[model samples]
Target: MSKVISRDGTIIEYDRTGDGPPIILVMGAFNDRSTGAPLAGQLEPDFTVINYDRRGKGESGDTLPYAIEREIEDLNALIAEVGGSAFVFGYSSGAVLALHAAVKGVPLSGLVLYDPPVEGYDGRLVHQLTELISAGRRGDAVEFFQSQLVGMPEQVVVQLRNAPFRPYLEAIAHTTVYDTKIVCEPPKQEELAGISVPVLVVAAEEMRDKFKQAAELLVSVLPKGQHLCLEGQSHHIVAPVLAPVVKKFLLS
Candidate 1:
């Protein structure tokens, strides 16, 4: 694993693979570098993939008081390690961070986002999550996050509960608060207008209208942007379909 120290003195750990322009994979909640392995493996041949554990999970350091800017700094540090500029692909909450980074003027060649959760769409969803967090029920918080925030079906949630990664998901479930902070506001069309980098907003076929709207909103705001929907796919199938799209956009 390669390591880079962020400006705030946190040690970030990452796995580097393939041989081309660096593409950093920023994971969403409930995912680490390992969780994205399958998708990363597929893109390894075309781009130098940098898959890293976000702070507070896996091999990265987590100091007190988690702020969204620090996570942005982590991305910057990773980009610096990989030769100053890169194409970035982010999923869910990580996508939110990537958008914020791009708006803040990080030197990115391109960006691809998959279903980033932004506030103001379905206020009831946020209310339910806040209630769960208030009750101090971490498991319920995780479930609400998957079902409500991620819009996963009941059957999918049940299957995941029985899956091997259940423990890992449970462990980082509390980090939803961090995700909430980063996505507290919906994507601003004006903010995205300043980003000159190419962007691709992807959505799953089964994603709700709100998600599709969010993707469309991003496409509208970005100076050079396009939108694609993965046919016959849902939130769970995002990584596999997304890898190819990211490869094509970044490598083209």
Candidate 2:
């Protein structure tokens, strides 16, 4: 395990492995370095993978009064520790952070984003999620997020409850507000136009229509972006499968 101290003095912990171009893995809500371990394992052979615990989870520190800019600084601090610019891949809310950083002029080798939930596509679901959080039903918030954001079926949600991810899910359940803040507004093409690095926007074939729309928006707006749809997969199943695609795009 490696650690980098951010400008704000938060200790961001990460695992560094493999050999080749550095690929930083930014996990979505409810995931830390451990939860993203499998996807990182798949890409380790071809790329140097940096999987980390974002603020408030795992071995990282969290300061109150969270601002999205701090998360961007966290990524910047990690990239600096790894010797500067590298390929970046973000999933869900993490994708929003990556996109924001890229637009802010972070030097990225390339980028791969999977199923990011941006605003304006649907407002009712976001309102419901906020309601769940306000009610202090963290577990229910997680379930609602999976079903509403990722469009998971009730049966699939039940299956996930028994998976090893249950704890991680619970950890970020209380942080749904943070996710909502990041996704409150749809990403602007003008904001994305500044990203000059190659990009791959991956979407799940089985995800909700909104996810597909979001992916399309990213691809269309990014200056150098390509879109790829993963057949027979949803958000959870697509991460590992997309890891290789990311490796190919970044390493090529």
Q: Model-by-model lDDT, in order?
A: 0.80, 0.80
10 residues in a row with least lDDT, candidate 2: 118-127
Worst 10 contiguous positions by lDDT, candidate 1: 118-127
**Pairs in steric clash, model 1:** none
lDDT (Cα, 0-100) at 154 in candidate 2: 92
Error of 2 at 49 (Å): 1.0
Give the root-mean-square deviation of each candidate in angstroms.
Answer: 2.7, 2.8
- Name the candidate that leads on lDDT: 1
lDDT of 2: 0.80
Please give the TM-score that candidate 2 achieves against the real structure: 0.85
lDDT per residue for candidate 2 within 197-239, as digits (tens), equals 9988888787657688777777887889898888887777345
